[model samples]
Target: MEQQNWSLATYCVAPHVAGTATLQGARLTDFGGLSVPIHTSSTYKVDSAEQGAVLASRKGWPELRKDGSTAKDEFFYSRWRNPTVAAVAAHLAALERAEGCLLFGTGMAAISTSVLSAVKAGDHIISQSSVYGGTFHLFSHYLRESFAVQVTFVNIEDLNTLERYIRPNTKVIYVESPSNPTLRLVNLEHIASIGKKHNILTIIDSTLATPINQQPLTLGIDVVVHSATKFLSGHSDLTAGAVLSNSQDFLKQVLFLQQTLGSTLSPFDAFLLARGLKTLHLRVSHQNNAALKIAHFLDTHPKVKVVHYPGLSSHKDFHLAQRQMSNGCGGLLSFELLGGREDGRKVIEHLQVINLAVSLGSVESLVEQAATMTHSQLNKEDLSEAGIDESLIRLSVGIENVDDLIEDLRQALEYV
Candidate 1:
């Protein structure tokens, strides 16, 4: 979709990739448009029964395979794939430096499908304790309760202990870096090496880090999943998810499950996702710089007890984060208040420039208390196990002027 030689920073802004996809198979050949056209058609026209049969049976991208035989790149139904969605998938694959990519209607769909594709009933999984609430619920409730799959949640800080959780049936090592709310760091290379040594598949939800900050696949991880609703769609106007991998076999499995589940992304949302990716590096870089400044500001404030951003020296994982994440730690940070949940609530409500919202990684700043908001699905005991504090306030810094963001935070702290 794009020039392979260009650096990642230049590739993010270059318009060649999106333009090429839009030009191919375009009905308005003379329109000379630069944007990707939404293929609203539910099914594609096939020349004959023979052609239709061949297209319907194919599982993954043709060019990625090593075999000499050629596989046609044709879609028969929207449930299987759409041209607009495929375009975005291709774009994401390029950004993530993967052999193939698949899109889903939601982040949970991507996570669930990715995990399910790896193992079945009687299988075991080792996951990080501090993960997105939806993922925790999936492994704890849906996968374990429904399928009888075994799961062990462990603190990823101590890499030495990961091997102890593995069993003969263990098939997957699942983790999230710069973990939600807590801003904890996981050594991607260390986990990937462990998975490789034990013949286990490693999957990471790189939503917070994005590809600009961290590409787990490049670090030897098996699969990378994303909630494109956040940083990938920086405007917060669309909801989508992606699964990417250098392993064609793994991607093919995800593709089959996505087709079976009918969790395809819409053409319009796909267009938005493609557009969002063009400026990903730019948006993330600005957010990264601004967030580091804000983290410093919050660290010094008396009302704030602790800041949980990897960028800060006070953070236990600062040195580790420097080795794992490039560009910047991330736009998200969490901090505690001396007065507990009440002060956290007041700070969120008092902020003017920053919105009091649940989601993160957008053009505007957002603040939410993790105890009652994002991780509320977990009970009190679960919260304690996950190390989430009631006073923890999560902040998602945006592209706003660093001074303005600091000033708004200053006033909010004063009010609290």
Candidate 2:
């Protein structure tokens, strides 16, 4: 198969148009087609046994200090790297304006590997009180028990708690902007500044606000991670993750740790991720617009208690979100049903257009009760501490027409 003669950056494609540029990479003439042919081969061939040994050795052990890669660092086996996976990473890096990017088999893989690569046993980590349930489990349960690492979760707005808790051994400050379920945003510039002042690495899981809506790296964060299965994939079909960094050193650590952990993203899933990136800008734009309309609708409804969307003027961090993400608030928002848990369930049962399921950034809308669904791992005390109410229903707006979505919600609210 012949590859595309025009590379991602071979022409007039601008950085602002990286989403479109990434799809162009898939149009490989080398494959004798326009779609990115999945390179599903588990292993690649070498010229000779001697060449194979050298290539295997290089692939087995990474040059952790190397910045730019050469053909020598090419894929030897699917475990270490894959051509299709690399293409997705390349596109993601371009999308985030990062020096490099690495893909993982799952979002947890990306988060866990990046954390392990940056910190060591006995080192401490400071993270926001609210984060994805999986992330919370890893930091509070797995990382603590397996590595003897210390973990402190503080409200993102509680700078005093964050500062007071920071210890000499604290090595990383991890945060999730527009945090899961809550949609509560952290001041990225503030947190990044704090990390720089303390000489600590800052890692942000910007899964809720995809690069199309927000780019934390530009706000001075050290590294950016994503659960690409969400908005990055657009459609809800694939599960994957990505790590992007401007620091070559940081990327090297993550890439090495990823291979060591054996959590590489599969080439097949990577191909799906690449196809998703093509319409990322388009999908997110529609999502953003629809989300604003939906949020406004929820706010004015008598059955709703409070709406947590940055687009709403009433949201506490509306200005902060405005400053950081001008494109729009993301496609997600959470609201409190007036009658609490029963009302939440009633609304879910009545919903026709919005799915009563988990996961976001998909073309189909999804609504889930945070306490029982996504954040079920958290105990009552932990949930209360994180300010997650039992009645909270997190809504992920899809590309569906805004009027139909609003109508669906209107009918659903009658049940509440």
Candidate 3:
């Protein structure tokens, strides 16, 4: 069978258009189906040992597609690469405006692989204090304790003093925009500029603000990482992660780490991820609208002490968010209760439509107390620094009706 061209379609596709018609990098089959076919084979059969060596080494396979393009980095072992995964990566690369992308078994796998690819045992890292709990643990504990790496958690707003924290050995400045639970945003352009000036790699975990809402690479960040398990997957069905970058060299390092770490995403999971990505724009747009409405409702409620949502004018970083995430402030928000932890507990118990669970970015709404849920590992002092308290309730708005969501929140607040 002659292999057809798997290049992106001829149409000039926009980044946010993830509908079936605009799904990029679909390899056409003889049947001419529009859907991306799942390549489930763990390994490919090569005609000779020479061809196998060529595929394994990824030195540009001799096999040519009908379009006169060689299958550079063709599939040999599933652990190294797979057709299904590569196709979805292409779509993600286009969406993220990155030169390349790599998939991993989980979000942590992606984060760990990307960071490890950049630094060794004694390298230093500067990270924002309000990153996701898992990332915090990876840096503060595993990387620090195991590898003797020096990590300084900084307040990104202190741009004037950030240079003081930098060391000649500093390799990466990591941060999360519209950071988890708090909904606080970092100045992406400034951070990117600082990284460039210092010749340091800048990486952002853009899970909260999906590429539909924000593209960090365009802001000059070196690399963008996502817990594709969140908004990218858009459903609670699959677990996957992605690391995207404009630097092919960085992506190559990530790819090598992914292959060595054996964190490759399976063909079926990659297929599901691709399917979820098809409606990315549609789902996120609805989520953005609903979240803003709910944020407004919570902001004005008497029982709420403070609502952390960049969409709200009262938010500290509203202007920064507007500058970076022009599409929307995303679907996540958090509010502290005036009555403290007891009131927060009552609110969670009374919610009917929203599930009292941990993960976010699903079709269904989820609510959780950050201190006890997502950021539980952070100690009391650490939690305070992250601006998380026992009274804070994080809400992940879904594609549900805004009125119903507001009503549900209203009734829940009434219980408090």
Among all candidates shown, the one with the greatest TM-score: 3
Pairs in clash, predicted candidate 1: none
What is the TM-score of candidate 1?
0.91
Q: Model 3 misses residue 289 by how many Å?
A: 0.7
Residues 1-416 of candidate 2: C-alpha lDDT, one tens digit per residue: 98544543332135457456555544322545756567888888767887788776764444421122324347688887776776567667767767678898889889999999988899999998899999999999988999999999998679544678889999999999889988888888888888999999999999989887788988999999999999999888889998888887888778777777899988788888878888888888899999998999999999999998988989988998889996888899999987998899899889998889899989999999999999999999999878899999999999988899999999999976
Better of 1 and 2 by TM-score: 2
Better-scoring candidate (lDDT), 1 or 2: 2
Error of 2 at 375 (Å): 0.3
Badly placed stretches (over 4 Å) of model 3 are 1-6, 9-28, 58-73
Segments of candidate 1 deviating more than 4 angstroms: 1-32, 59-73
Clashing pairs in 3: none
The ten-residue window of minimal lDDT in model 1 covers 21-30
Tens digit of per-residue lDDT, candidate 3, span 82-180: 777877777777777677778888999999999999999889999989889999999999999999999999865664467789999999999899899
Candidate 3 lDDT score relative to the true structure: 0.83
